[model samples]
Target: MRLGAIADDVTGACDLAGRVAEAGLPTTVLLPAPPAPGHPSPTTEHHEDVFAGGDDASACAVVALKVRTAPVGQAVDEATAAAQLLLDAGASLLYQKYCSTFDSTPAGNIGPIADALVALAGADGTVGTPATPGARRTQYEGILFADGVPLAESPMRDHPLTPMRDSSVVRLLAAQTAAPVSLVPWEAVQRGAAEVASAIGAGHTLVDALTEGDLDVIAAAILSAPRPVVAAGGAGVGTALARAAVAASGQRVDISRSQLPEVPVTGRLLLAGSASAATRAQTAAFAGERHTLDPLALATDDRALDRLRDALAARADHREPVLIGSAPEVARAQAELGAERAAALIEGALAELAAFAVHELGYSHLLVAGGETSGAVTARLGVQRLLVGQQVAPGVPWAVARSGEREIALLLKSGNFGGPGLFTDAWEVAP
Candidate 1:
């Protein structure tokens, strides 16, 4: 059994899963949700059942965990608890979700967790982390062993984040174990997938030709290959990507979304107007209806923002997905409106979405309109990134960036590209 685990925050989970599936590996992911301290441990029985159904249960499973920023104490505890559970479950390989925000400080949150996991898994264990110094705007040296050996390290160059830095420590640790190491960059993964597909079409070793960010392309390349394909990642994005991978491979593949069901809605409602216009529309759109709220609305000053928050207090309430248009402009306006006001609008929107997901909608799926909106929304939600843009086989967009945990999938078109289809592609909508 070649088991692989991806430990990361929510956004990273999706990105990694998409890449892994692209690599043509059967994979599973353990995603993070808001902590439920009093609740009993969720069941893994279903996962086991599913794995057993596979030809080689032991050989096929890969688990990825997305780590979130928690109180230093709680983060350590959660990591330890998760590691113990994986060990008990006989997980073959484990990867820790590392980030500058949580793991960069001297007394960082993930170090303790990684140490604990190493102790638990011994030689079989691997710790992985992403280098994200730019997004966090802070710096710290990698941890050292008692014998003066550095744990693990990987560079964060070309990652789609601001003032980029390296997330090499965890990768270094994983490499030390000589376990199958994966370096995940939001754009690299997708691009790599494309390249691998081209290579496979030309003839190459499935493993030898594999490189960082080649998962998606490799999976696509191996569509006709003899090996079984597995796609997995965090809940929402993972589910979508896995679906795409399965469709692309023309094969039956196993995948899972977040256990938390999302609030359902009807009508592809598009929220338009200025930031304020969209904000005003969001309140009315979801007032009493049961629908998913788009996290991007947080970037605007919508009048309904407050009302939506109030409505989401009850478990039965659900709001419609609020799409925020012209997000880059809105963000700029908000900045001019002063950080406090800007944050308030964004915060209000996020609070509404969170409440609705946890209570009313049960964590529903929502899509943002633009890359900027996707970035802003996910950032406010404490997610590092959200996979934006749709893939039409081999068509590559003009711009793409991967921030710390966030990824902005942008599809840009020139004014002269095409009169009508340009707008459609920009919005990732079918023409």
Candidate 2:
């Protein structure tokens, strides 16, 4: 594998994998596998031959993990193992994919995991920039901006898990790793790729990217540097990495996966659990029959689950697209039932609803919006891996996974991704 990616969440993995596929390098996002004792290390080739079965698979693989908010020690161990396996797969480059806003607590999985991966790779240092301009997240002068506003002042402050209350990436990472946090501003990056190489050679574990151009600089420098350096960030970074790989090699490898079949307008079910403003807006502006389940009602009412299933089933019978979600009042429910309990209730309920929709309601396509929600739904459906297909939109794809004897289509979207018409426009022809 030429490029091996490790994403902190399922949506983020799909986002990165889609970006890689768009760049002409066939990529597969594998579900997390337990690091079993005495088991042969899972390589990119082995995973593609087994889970990602199809035509000749490319040399890029993305592994998605649910360790975004796990305990620090556990996160570190798993990341180290992932890095070792990717290296074993013969990938010359490793990218740690996270949220565009660099979502993590002061006591972090980001910093600690970076430390472990870097130590395992025996690299000079790891770069830090989650600037996915497609998602409206950028960094300049060491501060992260979300839609032109500081992250702390954005809607993410209300996030239930790993609320980003800080805008300075350097400060946030400093508290988690002992490595010296350095900033490579846009000015230095614009000077040329050589400056970026100099910074990495001198040991700058963290850098800054203000726009798409800056990502090019970082990628070029890393790919041509004297010593190997690990690239880290969101889908934007993956784009630049693809460009750098092609530029350095002076060619694009052949890939066989064709565009997905035309997406049918009906028999589609949208399930959203993200509480972010983007998701809330998309949910409210849904063009299909919308049913917003109240968490309180879902938790207290004995028949709430059955009622939701019946409502979705009715839509299926009529051949109409449906949007069923519990995203209206997450904070209120969290306040009533506590954060952990409320989140668990919502995730569990949505996973159950999705299972019924796919197997019993006969929905062919499933759309999920959120990280924890996707993890729960995929786990409940017993999907061990996913076969990537064409793009539904930027950072969104129409992938297929096996559930029993059926192959179900899916689109997993991150909280901050997609525009206002995302829910409605998702049914449009694949790009």
Candidate 3:
């Protein structure tokens, strides 16, 4: 079947599948979780048992498994068993999950897995991560015993997992591989659909292997005619990718009999500090409204209250979106705003909903601009699992989880992450 498997953290798996699909291979992604909410208890029980079985049919049939818990030795043991089972089932290809904390170096993780896979397959095998260059060197030294190949992806260039992606293990794999290791450039796909088309036009075969978020971008790419589309990754990205592929290819996108997720987004955001001028400008530009969140007014002076109120009022008047900037600063500001003031803002926004409009007010989307503020707002709200972006950096590290009735989207940024036009790149197409 010329099949491939991707095993990594949840986000890495989804990102990798998106790249692999661009590279042109039929793929499947298997996550540890079941998709349906309140699904049959037996389904969850069966999945866990499948791993405990450590057999080939179970392993070969399985494409990807996300290990959320740490001390990864146990996860590795389970993976080894599954690999053995898959080999017994006549499977030749396999991939393992790699994390920075466990291996300390990419090769530390990749080498042993490759050696094991080679021993089992009696042939070469692939191991990879979206880690980084220095770590890749360390991985190369560790992989002395086996023929290792590294698969690299671009979307994760600045990702927290960079340590794993750029490790020596990946570089060595890329150098040794017969063909150029698949390069899934984040910039190419960030434009959503057109990049997929461009990749196929550039001679790559498209595989529909996304399993998170919406498939709107992927669907647009498939419609452009990338051949042999295969769906895999997080259940959300996978299902959406499969549906899109089916609609495009006029055939069903075969799915593994694994449980998947129903909703596309999960996680939360934490904002801290006052909004930066650049952030307000960017938000205003993106939302097609005038800048309202005044950082100067909110931070340097004691008028944060008035500034926040004014910002909210402006949003109400123009129906423009409001994005809180910073997390740490917001936390500090919270002391001044007090529980009563903070709750009033949130409660006021919520009140604007149809039923509460007379007595309450609310926002369509609460975008906390800064990571620190995000944390403060979430804590004040007494909610956990809110979407959070990594400490303000290059690409916003978005973590989405369910929060009551709200689907929070946090866009984290720092003064140094970029200047006024940083996010403009997100909207640009790769030339």
Candidate 4:
């Protein structure tokens, strides 16, 4: 692999992988192996089985870990192992990919995980930004904004897992790590790569980027840094990183090679498990066979599982896609059961249903919404890696995976990504 990215979640990994492929590098997204018997989850294992159809020597990779909200130490250890696997596989550049919202608590998985990757890569420090303009997320003067509003004043502030109460990346990162946090202002970024590179130091630098040009400048600066370079960002910088990597190596990626890999198209299902505003809108906008799982009922009642299973079974002969999701009232569920407990319960139930749909119902085309939901579903389906395919939305792509002889086409969408028609319109471009 020429460039490796360690993302905190499945959606982020697919998001970065899509950008990398857009830059003309054939990309793959690898999920960490499921734990062995009696072992903890997210145990790292070298996946030689990935990139099934692509040339390993020419392809890039993104390792998606279920650590966005995991405990700090666990996230660090898992991410470190993933980085080692990528680096040992011959990746010269490492990109730490997270959400454009910069989702994290004060005791971060982002800061600590980045610190670990930086140490493992033996880099001076990493520069990061969550500026994905197409997604309406951008940074200026080290402060994150969503659709022109400061992050703290935006919908992300009400996030269930990691409420972003502050918009300043410098302050948020400084609160999580003992090391000093620095900034590369737009002034330096506009001056070009050399000036931005000079601003980097032995501590994490939060670079400002409001446009694609700024991202190119920031990515060029990262490439020009010392060997074994490590950087961080969302999909915006990830695209730039891929471009810079190809340019630095004097490579000519065949853009015409962009096409979705062949996979089975039967038994299409849309599983929505996120309560984000975008996801809620998508669920509401979808005009199809929809089944809503009440979080409270699913957590407390066993028949909820049977009902959902029967619902899927009833659709066996139907060709229209079915949309299944939990109730949108996450706060009520969290109040009834603790936050983590409620999330675990819902995710576990959803994961079980996904496996049943794929294995028992013969589902091959799956659209999963939400980071945590996608992680659980993919793990339950025992998917180790995915081949990145044509994007159905900005930062959202069709990922193809194989389970034995069955090829599954998965479109894993972040809860906060995609339009209202995402759940319905995505099928028009299925692989």
Best by TM-score: 4
In candidate 4, stretches whose alpha carbon ends up further than 4 angstroms from where it belongs are 37-43, 49-58, 226-228, 248-259
Give the RMSD in angstroms, all C-alphas superposed, for model 4: 2.0
At residue 130, candidate 1 shows an lDDT of 29
Question: TM-score, each model?
Answer: 0.42, 0.90, 0.33, 0.95
Worst 10 residues of 4 by lDDT: 49-58
lDDT of each: 0.34, 0.76, 0.34, 0.83
Off by over 4 Å in 3: 22-28, 34-72, 81-92, 96-107, 119-431
Total colliding residue pairs, candidate 3:
76
How do the residues 1-431 of candidate 4 rate in per-residue lDDT, one tens digit apiece?
37788999999998888767877877888888865776554665557543335354346788889999988877887888888888877777788998999899898888898888888988877886989987889998889999899999999998888988999988988888877789989888889999988888877888999998899998888877754457898889888877776776787566336555677566888888898999999999998888877778976787988998998998755357898888777799889987887788778888888888888888888899999999999888888878787788888888789765677899998999999999889988878
> Highest lDDT: which candidate?
4
Write candidate 1's Cα lDDT for 1-431 as tens digits: 33434344433433343334433445434423334567433223324332344342322232323233334556555565555555556654444544322224333444445545555555322212222211211212333221122222222231112112323343333332323334233333346444433322111121221122233343343343232222221222222234444555576433222111122332122222213322333333433334333234444436456555554444342334333333334445444665435444543454345434433434333433222232334444443212222322211122222323322232221111122223223333311
Q: Write the per-residue lDDT of candidate 3 for residues 1-431, one digit (tens) a residue.
A: 22334343333333334333332223333333322465321112223332223211222234333333322454454455555544444543344433322222332333344444445444422322223211121122222111123323322222222223543332434332233334334355565666655564221122222223224454455445334322222222332333454455464322222222223322111122324444545544453332333333444556655554454454434233333433323333446675335433432332222112111244322334432233333333323322222212222233333334644333323221334444443222110
Relative to the unseen true structure, what is the C-alpha lDDT of residue 245 in candidate 2, on a scale of 0 to 100? 69
- For model 2, name the residue pairs that clash: none
List the candidates ranked by lDDT, beginning with the highest.
4, 2, 1, 3
